[model samples]
Target: MAENIREHLRRLLSVPPGKGKPVFLFWLYFFLVITSYYLIKPVRDGLFLEHLGSGMLPWFYLLNTGLGLLVVCLYNQVRRRIRAVPFIQTIGCALILVFFGFRFLFGTFPALAASLFHSWASVYNLVVVLMFWSFADDFFSLDEGKRFFGFIGTGGVLGGVVGGWLAGLLAEILGSANLLIVSSGVLFLGLVVVQILGMAVPSRRGKGLADDQEGEQLGSGFGFASLYRSPYLRLIAVVVTLTMLCTTLLNLQFNRGVELAGFNGDELTSFFGSFYAWMNASALGLQVLVVGPVNRRFGPLPGLAVLPLICFGVFADGLFAASFSVLVLGYGAALSVLYSLNQSSRELLFIPLGIEEKYRAKAFIDVVFFRLGDSLAALAQLLLVSTALFGAAVLQVLGILVSLGWLITLRVLQRQTS
Candidate 1:
């Protein structure tokens, strides 16, 4: 009966024989990583909103962008010197310590802690998630990526659901600061999983690369220079930048709407938690029922196009009705799609690139360029709102315009990928 169940799961996830253990390990690794992030995400947002308020979000976004660059650059350097497993282990230990420190400081330095934690959380997710996918890109072949990435990504969606649910249930009972301890514990578990995975499947480098080469430094060149030389990477960077701009604008609007609804303290934390839970739950369903079949049948083009189209509709609706419920539904829908189909497809794009492109260049694109979009959005908000030159309607219009641009860029990317 147990063997039958295992066989069923293998069939459902399209896991070929001999690949089950590594796939399962990778799935569990991603599950723990995302679960850890979601566990603290609500707390991070709530503390920032409660102590700093929504108005200061732009400055925080800019600060995050600056810090993200420094962190990713340092990450790229370290990744070059160490093997993948030890590199991740070192980062994981440091992050656990930081979380513990934040928990201790929250009581005495609420504002200062909140400010620092907010920036750190933004960079943390990017670094951790990028590391996971970069390693996966190296480990899996292109054909395997298409067959298995959707199933692998489902682990993250499930983690988001579980983590979000726990955050909502525990915030009021355990207090927001205590959630950091839980998050750290979850991250430690992820590190354990990583160690086991390394022992199980030590050779994660691409074809023709020796296992020992995994520890050698990557080719000496800036990721930006590589990004500039490749038209494909350039297009990807632009599309990603646009996506983040839309996300940042929607987030600002969502936070304002939540504030208008008069939520604060634990109530605000719980609200954010519940919101993430519902969003991830929706994503979980789509990942199981939609992403794999769609990617297998129609290919990743549809996955690539879905979010921008959803954002276009959502932004257009916001022009007529900017209610809290509308923003909730709209933002939730966008994020659900983003995390499920869109995310899997994006990672699949990296599978065909060289190792340096996969690790160094991809890190730059995911971290620095990702935050570049947020910084631009924040700057736009600061300039327009502070000058009273435009209101929320203008931002909606901007989202609509950006969505159109995203669609156009995807077409170009499709041609190149084709």
Candidate 2:
């Protein structure tokens, strides 16, 4: 009966025949990387709110934007020399060192230390996940991606649940600062998973480069040139930008709500952590039980449309009240739907592109353009907050408008890709 149940789940999840091992390895990698990152995410949010206040986050977002551009440029250069796995390992090592440095400095100057960690964590979370997608694109065929990507993504969602719950449980005892060491440990374990993948997957060697990747040179000029040249890429950039705008606005509002709810230190950390756990748990269930079957039956369009549709319905009802429970449910629904359905669809959209476009141009879209959108959204939010008149309500309206644009972009993108 147990074996039969296992087979049933395998079929339901659309696991490809004879590809179980590779899929599991990919799942493990995704799980480890996201677990490491999510462990820090809530802690980072709590620290920033405690030390910098909710209003100052726009400055950090702007700082992250500039730093993200620099990192993208440097990453493009570094990828020219090193393969994907080694590059990931190097990043993990550097983050481990940085966490230690933060730990030492946190004793004397908490705010400055937390600020630096916040910026770095933002970059770390996006870049690592994007790199994994890039690696997967190089290794898997388009057909395989459509079938397996959703299932693989569930691992990350599950990881988020675990990491968030663990952080919540540990926050009181370990404190938010010590969570840095825990994050570093998980990241190192992720690197070890990468090494295992290096040995287990034969075609995964040499940075998971595709056959067409042979002639592509590394002097890609931040990938903006290709992005400007391709209409498809431009549309994707716009979608990313608008999505970031909506998310940033929602996040700012959520943070303010949390602050107003008046939780501090360990209480704040645990609250955010449990909130993250619930969101990701919902995302995990959707990815496992809904997204894969939905994609198989209807295609990526429905999956792509889910988030914007949810946003339009919820945010359009009334003003965004800055309260703990309301923010929890609102942001939770938005994030869960976005991460489960929208993210899986977005990653699969890259499958048909060339290797250079997939890795380099996609990097620009994922890292630089995404952060640029965050920066712009943060600036907008900053201006609204400064005016001190109906800031949260206006932001909710902006989110609704952005969601409408997102739906239109999805329609166009589907037509073009189809």
Candidate 3:
């Protein structure tokens, strides 16, 4: 078994590097975006809490979040020829949302105008990230991914660590809105970097278009029908999606748990900074050590599905008996490791999927299904927090059900594999 695993690792890593031109460009532009958006990420969370205050009923925030996510999703689906079209679209939409909301609310609560502005700005940056990674996945071949994968992820990890630390330090001085402006400016720089890289070295990876193997051809709005046709890809998507949803539930609960434990403001922001940095850093570490090896140790499908199945019961505990310490120490650390491991391996396996599935279907899962999961979890929490129909105990029960669904999804995957 050990010998076989080593051989598998060799095959995965043996792929030749990208014509460093495109990969180089990707590295340069990708991390810059990290530095840019991360500049605001830590500070923004605190501000979001401040604005929402105790009044942030789950539905109220969830409703706006869902609504905003919908608009962002639509905008994301809209593609244009100008390569930079999406970047501009994201930033422009954020600007419009901020300006409109601020103008309407500034008179009544002038202080919060910038807060609202920064809040939406964070959304815009997230859209950029979701799209950028999808674009990278679409543009790079599996072989190319093997070579550049670690290096590319390394940039984001470093940027996040630095950005998180900066926010922790700058909370009172630069203020959250200023951090947002900085993040926005960094994003603008990212847009510029992508364009420069696009022109300097055009992407030479295979087009996302497909042959009859996938139900439809690519470049046709991600060939949605053909995308799901691959039972393999479909199962991957389901597992990948459920994992993402679990991540959201863990993250939201973790933060709320922190505050419930009586930490706030700069201290809270610092804690977040530490948490996010560790998560990203840990993912990078696993890519080097565990991910590829584990996938080879277990088949791709089983490797992909196993983590969440095992973790579901462990994580389900957070919904009920969770506290700030327990949340951070147990759920936060455990889930972060789980997420990082799952994401790294999932990326490895995704290389085998059809190109359309790689780009389009992956995009839908990353943004829509992923957010759909988050919104649903939020709704669940909303009901629990608000009415009498449910509670944290119910959330634990639901998580158990999702876990069972996870196990069944694995059976479906194994059947497809046969």
Please report the candidate that would top TM-score against the real structure: 1
lDDT of 1 by residue, 195-286 (tens): 99889888466443453355334332456778989998888888889889988888887887887798869888888988999999998888
Error of 3 at 164 (Å): 1.6
Cα RMSD for candidate 1?
3.7
What stretches of model 3 exceed 4 Å from their correct place? 1-22, 54-57, 60-78, 85-122, 130-146, 188-192, 195-199, 202-234, 305-316, 319-321, 348-359
Worst 10 residues of 1 by lDDT: 211-220
lDDT of each: 0.85, 0.79, 0.60
Q: Model 1: residues >4 Å from true position, as ranges? A: 11-19, 134-147, 198-233, 293-303, 344-364, 408-418
Model 3, 290-347: lDDT tens per residue?
7668777876666566566645745666655554555566554555456556666666
How well does candidate 3 score on lDDT at residue 264?
55
lDDT score, residue 207, model 3?
38
TM-score of 3: 0.74
* Model 3, residue pairs in steric clash: 209-218, 210-218
Residue pairs with backbone atoms closer than 3 Å in model 1 (clashes): none
The candidate 2 region of ten consecutive residues with least summed lDDT is 210-219
The deviation in Å at residue 391 for candidate 3 is 3.3
TM-score of 2: 0.82
